[model samples]
Target chain A: MTGIDQTSLSRSTSLKLFGYHPVVIIVAVLLLFMPLIANDFILYQIFSWSFMLGIVALSLMFLAGYGGMVSLAQMTIAGFAGYMVAIFGVNGIASVSIGWPWWLAVPMALFLATLLGTITGALAVRTEGIYTIMITLAIAAAFFYFTNQNYAIFNGHTGINRVATPHFLGVEWRSTVPFYYLTLGFAVLCYWVTSWISRAPFGLALQGVRDNPRRMAALGFNVNAHRIAAYVYASFMASIGGILLVWGNGQISPGSVSVDVAIDNLIIAVVGGISRPIGAFIGALIYVVLRTFALDVLVAFGLDGNRFRLLIGIGFLAIVFFSPDGVIGLWNRWRNRHASVSTVRQGGAHG
Target chain B: MRRFIERHPLWSLFIIVVIFVFLWLVFATWPPGFEAIFGKKKVFLNAVLNGITLGGLYFLVASGFTLIFGLMRNVNLAHGSLYLFGGYMGFKTVAWTGSWLFSFVVAFVAAALLGIILQYLVFRRMEGQDLRQTLVTIGISIVLADLMLWIFGGDFYQIQTPDWLVGPAQMPFVTAIKSSGEAVYMTYPIVRLAIFAASVVIGLAMWLVLNRSKIGMIIRAGVDDKDMLSSMGVPIQLVFLLVFAFGAGLAGMAGVVGGTFQSISPGEDTRFLLASLVVVIVGGMGSIPGAALGALLIGLAEQLGSVYAPTYAVVLTFLIMVVVLAIRPQGLLAR
Candidate 1:
């Protein structure tokens, strides 16, 4: 059996455990000091936004890369969690919110969001490829419409506003430094968990299912269940990001769950590199930076600021056309070329 | 009748009766109990008629979507943008020349040319890669949408149909009975009828070309087995290009027709695209008849829901889609 290669599997697992690259350490160190170096706007608006968006994109990356399921409902799932928080937790819209404590509301919101993701996953796993995209997109569209219309719960199009952030142990989590740390901690935890999962047996089996489900099934794997499980894990990650996002914005609105945002999640995951978790963060950084600055640049050039999406679209197209594997793929190619060049130089010296 | 009923267990008859009762309640009872819920009976009739015409417009857009998907396996998310672009072009042409026919032709040609460019530049390179193609099309759509907003100034615009089709036409068959037992005749916009007629003609023409012509045969074969068709010297790329252009041209035509009756706004691109998606998904992907059927169901659901439950109109179509998908995941008419 293909699963019988125990020696190579153990060796690979050990290598993964010990393979702490220097670049990762350097990047981590830099991120740890970001809030200290950056100003309030930079810390709150750019970095925190990037981390939250990155977390959601990372969840999408896990599903698409490992489960072969390109779901368009990732944003919808995030939005659902945000809505749950708004409904259960205290908010400015006091009439609508039930005003539950953070300790109780957070888990309840995450639970409901996870259930929604599992149900969607169960429905979506029946289809393949393009149909899967259609189904997830339909769900996203439906959710958007439902929330936009259902005034009793979602407060109609305006959504619930002024959602209060968690306050515990005399820490004002909404402050820049504390919020940044909170976001960073969650981001790092998610990234680490996703990386660990990628090397785990279930993740390997899911990848097998992604490449060839029939072969994986022949090898005694329950493909759909595994896919559903992946969705659950991804939903938890996205739910956490969504809670953070709502706190960051201090609101939850129907606009936040728009189809454009859903598509943006896909674009972020794709532009970063769908195969790796780190790529999602890298892509989020690029996207947030561009979104923040591109409008200013456009207005400076006497162009319309509203057309910033045009530049982003163009960038996405160019990136996809040039490198389908995204920024990570480009990095890998460059590294390979550098390694080959050095080896060639060494061979010449030996000759 | 009794023997037939006995053989079929009366389920069909019961369904017909239920439908008739629903229609009666919707169309013939002014000041009825539902008036409190769904407005007046006149509004219900208008909604039904409106739904039929809207379904026709939806069919015009979705037929192209289905054709492309059936032939190339490419889900062109930019389709809605194409529709909106064509509408804008048609609007400009009409403004310039005041000839609805000329505007229609110009819109079709421009959209077809754009489609050709898209196939060669973007979709052609991605070929069978569905995810990449989807992303590329989305990118193209975003740029096109932004450009259109820039040029069109984010205002809602509608094409003016010819003077001959501007007035309302009296419908002899549609008579709503008031509570006083008086018959109230209903009138519908002539442009709506024209739209329905145009859609029917387009649907028939497409059916003929797909079923009768040699090119149609080749397209059908390609949809079934692309690799086999290519190996048999069919020049599948040429067929794909032709199909893509033709599909895009159909969307342009739909834009013109839809623009005549409804306002074309910046957001209409995604709306039409979403409608077309719902149609194809419910009717069955890659099936022309399925697209038509699905469009009709969605149109009726949307209109009826708007009248009965205005707040939930959008959700109604989605509900239909979800129900259909749950019951038959391959859709109603999967090819």
Candidate 2:
């Protein structure tokens, strides 16, 4: 065998044996070396925000991909968790402030957030497709205006502010490098769990329900129970994201959990490709990059920065128009094309 | 009397009327007396009038929303973007021509064209694919909103009415009495009165079209069953496109009229969008009369709510939405 051929074959075999898709392996390598290549701000913006939003979007994907429920209320859950943290800390308008340490507060907040999600999920899962979306939207709308107006409990329209980052192991988790690492660890953990669950029996059953619920029910699966469980699982991921988002922004406001934010999560998930967990991270990266950089580009052209939204809207429309499967689908198509070209070359050589 | 009462359900009717009357009397008498005794500004009447005008504008927008939702069965989340787009378009046209007549013509045509293009490009392809379409259109709406922000900036812009229709007119009864004992005339803006008239005309036109026209019959039939209509060779796609465009055009007209009455700003998109959604939910998704009635309730309620409790104005509409949904999941006028 030729020297180059031997090396290539070994590399391909190693990728297979490690059970790492080329995309995942590359991403892992990049993330491992990201600190070396990127400055602190770049790391925070690209790695941290991507991971945080990815985690949030992952929750939505779980609902959309596994449970066959497209929930717009994921942001609402995150926002709820965020508000819980602020309220429990010194910022809440309610007279009842917990003032608990991060260890207690975060867990409590996450738990409450999960319960909120489960309730929303329970209410939402009763309907399917468009109705599911509308109900979640209604719930989200209710939560939004409630937060906007309920000054006594939620601190009203301005929302609660100055929520402190959790101090874990005597380390301030909000520091750029530390936070990025913390986020990376969580993201990797969630991705692994998501992949693992998608392959598990429950995941298989959920898929069965997604593809055909009536048949799954006939086979003795409690479809509603499975769906609710999926929502609970998804809510856990979203709560984590919400917690991280609080740390990232240093505050939680009505805007954080607004209808726009809910829709933004949907856009990120759709942009990333709903088929996998990594899709959320990828989608978040794309959305954040577009949103962050598009401002600079518009400003450079002497155009108002606010118009960056217009560009994002156009980009989203185009993405939906062409690739309903999103960026992952595009990546897959490119990979498939390369695979075909290589296979054709191999056939020619053999002949 | 017992037989007549049973046949007419007089007790139930009597209770409803009595409650309504009691509520109205309490609202009318208590607020003024409290204000007079407490030496507070008797701003309640003025606020209600203002709220009515605001509600009238909302009705125009929400009626469009209800029409599209009713016929197409697609909750175009981007409807807010369209509403904002119309306002921006009207603003631009007014900027260009500097004439009210030309501005109307330009705004209407521009908005209609925009509606047609959006329908042809985005919504038409989303016919059967509901979820993706919603997501896609939301993106489009955001982009459009951002585009407007880019073009117009975040600053609020006011559409100037004609010279003849500017300013407010004098009223009689409320004006005659004040703390100073001077004649205080209740002033109403001419532009707002014109908008109300225009809306009535537009609503009448729509009612006639839907109730009378053959095309309207086809549209009603299409809404009933797109598949059944298509099977009969009724170009369902075309009908959807038309409906989407028509809805967008209405949004545009409302924006132009709304801009003249109330200032247009970047944040107006979400506010009006939510209001329109509320209207559809309250009015019953496909019912025309429901949109009008829902609009009236929303408008009056908002005015009255703000007058009585400024803090509760936002909650009032949302509370109404929740209550309506709980009572009738199909909405106030759903078929």
Per-residue C-alpha lDDT of model 2 across residues A1-351, encoded as one tens digit per residue: 001112134344555636756866787889988888999989998779989899999999878876778998999998888778776765434463557777777888899999999988876665577767766776677688778877777877777777777776888888888899988988888888987898789988988888789999999999999999999999988999888888788888788888888888988988887766677888999998887788889899998676666676777777777777678667755655676666322211100
In the range B61-101, model 2's lDDT, one tens digit per residue, is 88777777777777777777777788878888878877876
Tens-digit per-residue lDDT, B29-131, candidate 1: 4555756765666777888888988999999899999999999999999999989988999999999999999988999999999999999877887788887
In candidate 1, stretches whose alpha carbon ends up further than 4 angstroms from where it belongs are A1-19, A300-302, A341-351, B1-39, B178-182
Question: What are the Cα lDDT values of the candidates?
Answer: 0.86, 0.76
Model 2 has an lDDT value of 0.76
For model 1, residues A1-351, the per-residue Cα lDDT tens digits are 022122233332333424754556778889899877899999988899999999999999999877779899989999999999989999988678999999999999999999999988888887888888888887888788889888888898899998989999999999999999999999999999998897899888888888889998998999888999999999998999999999999998989998889988988988898767888999999999999999899999998888888898898988788777788767755655675675322111100
Residue pairs with colliding backbones in model 1 are: none
Report residue B94 deviation for candidate 2 (angstroms): 4.2
Write down the C-alpha DockQ for each prediction. 0.50, 0.29
